[model samples]
Target: MLKAQETVLEIDLKALKHNFDHLKSRISSNTKFMAVVKAFAYGSDACEIANYLQKLPVDYFAVAFVHEGIQLREAGITKPILVLHPQAVNFNILIENCLEPSIYNVKILNEFIATASAEKLNDYPIHIKFNTGLNRLGFSENDVDTIISTVNESTSVKIESVFSHLAASEDLNEKDFTLNQIKKFKNITENMTKQMGYKPLLHMCNTSGILNYPEAHFDMVRSGIGLYGFGNSEKENKNFKPIGTLKTIISQIHAIEKGESVGYNRAYKTDTFLRTATLPIGHADGIGRQYGKGKGYVIINNQKAYILGNVCMDMIMVDVTNIDCKEGDEVIVFGPETTAENLAKTANTISYELITAISQRVKRLFIGN
Candidate 1:
């Protein structure tokens, strides 16, 4: 068995379950809940997280790529899985794995239809993504006719759902814009369903959308950050327990004289004699270089230690002055005491980037609930 003491990412399944239940409570009984476990479950551990959620009877599981869905299937997940942004090249493999793909445009719709027909697949479920407002991925309103024609001409594929992405559901300032997107998506869904004579599950809400706009909770809500415990806003996060706790042991300590410098290019200079501790985590481990130079911090023995100097690929130095610490002391990089949200704000990024940027090299130890 792998020891928890040997890792940085300590995944709390108890917390994961807590967050899921919290979000579940907010959802309507008619609304299906889909858990987004892509990017290794936001860089925690996708397989373990999915396996845990599968036991909780989530309505659906979504991944960004076909291979990620395959990973969940390989891990014995038998739930309905959606490939949120599958490429045309993987349509066959996606079909083989019984994974649903989100058809965004004419090219992908045509490709999927051809592949499903060639494979002799009948009524394989697929989702249509409309570009309500995000403009990142999804078919435009003008492309709907072409998409409907493709679907009507194919006997091998069926529309499983029609969805869109919300560009700013978290910002209350953008409420009007978000509502506009909701209206657009509703209008598009109505138009397409009228043309096709059937409506699949309609979803356009992410974690933030699900919490902020219940009226737009069409048929399902896809949760990514909410499942991990950090909502897009502080108000939304209050109801959920955070699922990931990033911690590492201090490998070494250093005593610096006044005016002494630390790390690359003397990025941090001690104003007075201070104690500094170095941990075996750096940018390569997803700590990121932007977290250094007094911009970010970590919690040591419940005390805040400002980061010093440029973050290296395998290590970062923290000014632990005035705190009683030693080599091998556990350091909380971003957890209960100091959140990844706080760290991200200091680094001019977001919690999503902080969590998702966590490299695969970091060791993950899952604690089952």
Candidate 2:
């Protein structure tokens, strides 16, 4: 519990383990866990998180691209890394790294087989993504027969897992839709398993899905936000602890008279005398412009200080007239108690976007192995 002298994101591995064990408790003992460490582990440092989880010994690890998986491999991660959206060009390198690819459509599957063949690889691990309702990636249910035929024809690749994503597992209003998605995934898996003559591992639950729909746990479950300490609902949120704490220090303070403006474009002009604290963090640090102009706030001396104006590339001014904080006083942008989810709500965004949007330049410090 040391104070931050400069802007830093403190990553608590203890909280991460707590979140992991919490999510792990919800699934059956036989179920597997897939740790999603894409987008730099939701902007908290991917290699560190993946390395930690690799020791937690998650059954599988998933990333958004081939490069992410390669990074994990380079980090001494021996567990199977699934590349969720790999390109044809990277397939060769991906195979060389022993990174599995998620084959979403015909072109990707065929091309991956071709690449595997070129590398003289037989039965290369691959995952199949089905478009249940996300519509962002994955193949159609109708494409299953074609997928079966394609895989049947190729000894170059093997289906490691069959999975899909839940579109709105967090919103109870979309419960019916979410259930329909589960039904479709089960149906698809049934057909795929029957046709393939052997079952690949099956998974569909994200963090929210893990909590809300245990019946869809399939063979394994993926936890990304959950591992970062967010359960996506008010009730379930209490069960997890946010691992990354964003903190900065006040660089300086300003006394502004009425009609004086702060920051770019005069976005915030005080109508009365006030004090402002300029912080060394802004859009470039992942505190976006949308969070400026009173839309977001920071915690100072346990008091809420609203952002004063337009966020600059490397700085933000916050109104701190009533707070007893001064220059170099530690400021909390978001953490376990304040919670990124709450701060994100103020800016009309989700925790995923807020956390993942954090810039890479900010230093990261880890606590507890």
Candidate 3:
């Protein structure tokens, strides 16, 4: 465990390695691994996470946009990066940086072909995303012929891989839908390979897909949240260790009389004489205003201190009357003992939103490096 002076998001590299190893153990050695490092590695600092995983030597890396891949390149990442959703305006630069693009629609496929041709790039690697059921992005299942024919007409671009996304692989209730997605993916890949006379690397599994739907693990699998230590299932989560711990310290303490109000709008009125501790974190730092008014809590001296009132942008007050603690005492916003998943439940949300919402303004400390 580590201590925090101010608000900090501590990233434990040892816990990260533990998570990566656990995920790798679930897949075959022959199958390649692609680490998705988009959204600042799910808001934990992309360069740091990517650099660490690069040493573990994942076969590939994926980002939601070309700019993210560009940032990785600027940060000295040398491995292949797959831009999951690239815009036409950035396609030329994407090629210039040697970053692959996911061509999901006819327009993207056609524009990327033009970009590659303009650069005179031969066999430039490009992945094709097919819409199975997620319906967020990807070519329709019927687009296989269109995709293959378009690529066949051009030597500038080449299919590096064919992949899709799983809508709900974690919930067993969605098993039938997920299976149908897999079936469609299989059919799309078969058609793609038979027509092109070549087998591009195939992948589709996300973090949960890697765990619950091992049968769908194709030539390569992408792991995002799992690498950060959340399996999205209670039983599977125990197998992973969350790498980030949110921590802060008490800045001041106050003894309020009964009926005294605390925070913005005086949302919380004391029922009896009680002491409260003010902390240096609030909604702007990713805690959110909804967590105020006793909905969220922090651990002080191993005791829960429910938030007293409305959360300020840069501060929060907690009822710490019972705890034998003082100003500057260490507090656990959320950590191993009090997991983010548990804390998020108080807000009617999931761990993903909570963890990723951590404001970059908060200092980040890396341990066990």
Candidate 3 wrongly placed segments (more than 4 Å) = none
lDDT string, candidate 2, 72-92, tens digits = 888888998888889998887
TM-score of each: 0.96, 0.98, 0.98
After superposition, candidate 1 runs with Cα above 4 Å error: 1-6
Candidate 2 steric clashes: 0
Candidate 3: tens digits of C-alpha lDDT, residues 1-369? 666788999999999999999989999999999999998898789999999999988989999999999999999899999999899999878977889999989998999898888888899999999889988999998888888889999999889999999999998999999999999999989988999998999999999999988899999999999988889988998999989899999999999999899998999998899999999998899999888999989999899999988999999999988899988899998887698988999989988899889999998888898
lDDT by residue (tens digit), candidate 1, 209-314: 9889999898999999989989877777778777778888788899999999999899888788988998888999898888888899888888888889999989
- In what order do the candidates fall by lDDT, top score first? 2, 3, 1
lDDT of 1 at 297: 89
Q: After superposing candidate 2, which stretches have Cα over 4 Å from the reference? A: none
> What value does the lDDT take at residue 168 in candidate 2?
98
